[model samples]
Target chain A: MRLEKCWFCSSTVYPGHGIQFVRNDAKIFRFCRSKCHKNFKMKRNPRKVKWTKAFRRLHGKDMTQDSTFEFERKRNRPERYDRNVTMETLKAIKKIDKIRVAREARHHKMRMKGKKGIEQKAAERELEQGISLVKAPLALREESSLTLSKIKVKVSQPQAEYQMEE
Target chain B: MAAFVASKWSKVGPPLLDNLRSSRLLEPFGKFQDIASPGWNGLLFQQLRTFIQMRTKLKVVDNSGAKWVRCIQALKGRKGARLGDTIIASVQEAQPRGKVKKGEVVYGVVVRAAMQRGRCDGSEIRFDDNAVVLVNKQGEPIGTRIFGPVPHELRRKKHLKILTLAEHIA
Candidate 1:
């Protein structure tokens, strides 16, 4: 059985699963679930939806251009199967899968290389903006200390005045 | 001068009209026009190769207690009924004490046609069995639940109730 991709989310729609919508013009759209179908009915763009593969690809979160992806593409032409070729292809599939995984991991690492520094910078900026919420204001702290000392001097002066009066 | 121009136009106009009528470009639009017309009786269009017969057996896909039904007549057309078309069928088999009794005639909407239907996206779909869901005179389904996959074309045919009751739309 041939596997279909969901029109909305780019997810695999296995046989006997998912819903297919054929428009009046004869265009077919397969949805993996009711959620994708509902989103499609709402006229939401796949690239605009944050959770969809189209969104991730458009936002540079996933590898968009890769030779590895070419292997998974659906080809209309069937190849003549030979015993030796089949064995080689089976061996090649495992090797290709391993290479693809390694490439994908490398791509992800490259994409995330500066993520830590960017996150730290963002945290610093946030702290700079909201530092007063977390800690007392330096100027206010200094002023409060001076005010406390002044209050102590005033209290002492009041005691001296009371003592003089006594 | 006017008479001369009219005579000249007549010679050109008929051939042009004939060419326009015979052209392949307007063929699909003509089918669309038939669909758009309110009085369309499904006579001129033969979308499906095989049509349901008067005595054709249909598997009921709903829980309204009918297991099988035989078509007595297809409504709105003398030829036959395709997917999404409604037919008057007599209950051939049903569960005991069910809402529908055996031998009772009921209206049913065709949910799945065994013949393959071509889509505009260069794909074709065919169901394994010919199935129907019992409905009333008001075009609303009598069954509360549907068991198998139905086509999205039913929705285009304005069978929203069937689409809602369906487990899947293919």
Candidate 2:
């Protein structure tokens, strides 16, 4: 079975669903639903319908310009379906997603490094106010770098530091 | 249910018409006066959104000969639509021999909204029910003749072409 992309929405049209409109010039236009079919029959412009993906892409809303989307390459036939190749492609996509997730976690930690300093300052101020605060489990660990840093902070502030703060 | 009033009042249509009444008094400082000298009086605005806010399967008064229209979009936030707002509606009941076919979505502009709308002069005007006029993207009314009295506000917004085709403006 072959899948076709809808002319208006550019979504995949399954075998039993969607409509096909044949123009006077023998060109066929496929629509994914009755909504798209009706809009096309009414001669409505795709650009004016803000809900359609075509409108989103035309207006440049987070849509990337893929190489296959090039006007000249549009007519190029898709490669024939191969079961083995499809399986390999699926595995490759999953591997890429795993790598992407790990990279994003690293980037998040890097972004939060500066924010942590600000948070620690607030936590230290609260500690000076005699407020009983529960430290995070990671901070409670004796050998953790965060706990070592906290001890260093306590040692730096002496009786003279308390006098200066008031 | 229809109730007949005593014929002592001057005969126009009746003492109580449901809608589409004409009140022609201009109040002080350019505000439109509601009917006040009353045994039974008329209303100025014939349509408003609060009365019949745009909803699916709601009846539409089409002067263009389509018997029914189904509103698809009420535009701004869907809480309700107001006068001069654009809407998308589908023709539900159309004659087989009419200009528009059934299931065709047409652009409609709110000619009258039920909510009281404030004018530039700090005065407000409201209509009896929510009403829309089918128009093209160029803002031209598709109907040859508007069914009832049109408001001057439609013309004030530069829709003079609709005013030219209208039989009366109130």
TM-score of each: 0.46, 0.33
- Candidate 1 lDDT over residue span B2-70, tens digit each: 334333333332223333334533454456444464322433342444777799999998999999999
The alpha-carbon root-mean-square deviation between model 1 and the true structure, to one decimal in Å, is 29.6
Which pairs clash in model 1? A26-B120
Q: What TM-score does chain B get in every candidate?
A: 0.67, 0.58
Global fold similarity of model 1 (TM-score):
0.46
lDDT of each: 0.74, 0.55
User: For candidate 1, what is the DockQ?
Assistant: 0.01
Tens digits of per-residue lDDT for model 2, B23-53? 2112123566796652112223322236324
Candidate 1, residues A1-58, lDDT tens digits: the string is 5888999999998876666665433356888786786677566789998999999999
